[model samples]
Target: MKKVLIPKRKLPWGSDHEAIIWLMAVLLVVGMVNVFSSTFITAENENSAPYAYLLKHLISMGIGFVLFAMSWRVDYHKWRDWLGPVALSIAALLLFVLAAGTVVNGAKRWIYLGAFSFQPAEFAKICSVMIAAYILSYRVEHKLPINILNAQYAFIAFLFVAVEMEPDMGTACVILGIPIVMLWMAGLKTYKLQRLALVGLAAVVGMCIYQPYRLERIKVMFNPWSDAQGMGYQTVQSVTAIGSGGFWGMGLGQGLAKYAYLPEAHTDFAFAVFCQENGFVLVALVLLLYGAFAYYAVRIARDAYDVYGQLLAGGIMLLVVGQAVVNISMVAGCFPVVGVPLPFISYGGTSLMMTMFSVGVLINIGRYSRAKQAKEKLDELRRNNLKNHEAALAAMPGRRRLQRIK
Candidate 1:
């Protein structure tokens, strides 16, 4: 049998956290630049300044960076205890949004705060992960039997209902998807898992039947050409934008489809805009970056110091990276057009900030794991030295005899 060789590359700043940051950095830079190129046209016509959208994105990025720094250094353990209150707070916000949220594109998802707006569901993703990690790890740690339908899952169900009511079907999927993945990773029993899957399937069917818009998306996905001007408009335009990019792209800020031709040039279909401006060459590079992020995120989760940390990091990775996969798939027409946003690349205030904070939490767990490994090595060495000293003392003279005599 041959052993596998996994190379360890040191991160900058001499940290043994085994953290990966460069890919995220690339995504942010590319996201900001592409977002600017994709929206400068609309911004120019909507406002006098062509850079207005870019300036707003920069402000959002600045806020996200601040959150990232704080979460990256904080201990991951604290979130375990604070999961309940945090989740409740998010649920309250969700309800408030339903009650008095600012509607956009016929959906009441964003809650306005004076001049700016933010999405509570964005933060709810993290809260959902935290609750799962906390409950699962707590059960294992305390030797409690797994109750599949405990208050923990009930809260998540409530959140799902709230988000779905917001008519943000895409975000609703993510809300439940995070928990299902976490629960599976946390080792749910096969029978219980099957039962949950059935329930989830039933829910999906109900949602699709209830929302004619969702059904329309499915129809458009299979053949956008049928209604290219109706429900298929966004999908047809999205694919068209990607196809127009060709091999080398039209160059930055040179894309014409974004000029009132394709909807959401900087949001759900931002990847399409990215391709339209940078072509397949940068697309390949961007995909590689996204892959690297997923790989390192899983590695960080695997290297966590404890069960709680492992579940925590794993859940965060699922939420962040999983959302990216969903969004990209929707844009490529591989999946139904759901409004899930790319993690760091999507032009938004809350999603980017929440994603950066997730990465920060992952990095913090990695740092803790490194320190734990060092401590374990030191303890092993001390034990070995003690054992050797005892052996030598015993062989030196009548150590056993002395003990017997005493």
Candidate 2:
């Protein structure tokens, strides 16, 4: 006799997950507006069309949407197999960038193609999370803290250091930190984890001291007025732009700071332009949306039926929230301007694509959670129905022993 082949099962996205995707879409729309606002004055100075930069960003956004849709359709679990190869490919690209990448403002962080550029560090981040999740899923006892020097963890650290050599500090930090958090959440050893963290900190400190620009950025952050016209100009202008908006804002497309005074107004400092035009109210709303997203991501982890799914959800959550903190901190002058872009709001093709891919993974995790819950609900219903049936049988005369069957 021939046996029948059964199809593999997959999960469906939950309501909250779908809501977050919509929120991301809304934020992208708002981001486009700010990108356009930041470009107008600069384009005028260069004799370019009024919307040249905005048009380019809009085009990128269109591409991002297509990638986002594709990601949503594919199964994230397949990445477990693809993670290693894709990561190796990305690692090679980063190495290539370090050796021959284009330099923009002293950092060789992009692989350029005539009119387009791609940041490998961006994609490397998501890949790191997926790889970390795959490695940590083997832990049998889910505890707290984790050893950082294990072969898998060390690989993650090495990958991050390679990205950092591209000298993308913000991406490097996130790439390294997110995996550590995921591993810790999956269970390891706390005292051992602390030791590795201290060593990592010392290494980072040494690297910072060796790099003049990185050191200079740190100094300027501590004292923005120290070099008001040089290293400090960006932060100072950012503060002014955010401050001028007050509580309500100067109104959309009416911001004075975008008149060429605030550098990177549409990219790294896009939040400032957003705050300038939309005020604290809208900024708070953006924060709320992010908070909601973070909340749902955690929920996905908590509800995941298996260890891999849990770690994957947690790692993705950490990546998004961690990046948000770094971006906002730079704009707020709490940290040095490390060139991290606001997710869904920054104007870059590679950044947008990677972010959407992470969202796709999170959506996949949500699907698993939904499937697990549905299965549990079905099992519970079956148990209840079985009990009811037995109880009804027990009610029949001479059926007193039916309760034992349950």
For each candidate in turn, the TM-score is: 0.92, 0.88
> Which pairs of residues collide in model 2?
164-167
Question: How would you encode candidate 1's per-residue C-alpha lDDT over 1-406 as one tens digit per residue?
Answer: 9999987755553442333566778789999998888888888888658888889999999998899899888888887767777888899999999999999989899988788889999988888888888888888788777656788888888888999998888888887788787877877778888898898889888998998778888878999989999989988899999999999998998987889999888988899998888999999999887877778778878878888888988888888778888888888888998878987787888998998888888889988898889999999999999999999877766867688679
Q: What is the C-alpha lDDT profile of model 2 across 1-406, one tens digit per residue? A: 9999986545333476776687787788887787887788888889999899888887777777787777777777788977777877987898899999999887898888999888888888888888888877865435433455577677777778887777777888888888877756867678867876897789778878877777889899998988999999999999888998989999998998877788788789989988988899999999998888898888878877788888888888888777888899999899998868898887777887788778887887787678778999999999999999999876876645556655
- Per lDDT, the best of the predicted structures is 1
Residue 75 of model 1: what lDDT?
89
TM-score of 1: 0.92
Q: How does candidate 1 score on lDDT? A: 0.85
Worst 10 residues of 1 by lDDT: 10-19
Model 2 scores a C-alpha lDDT of 0.82
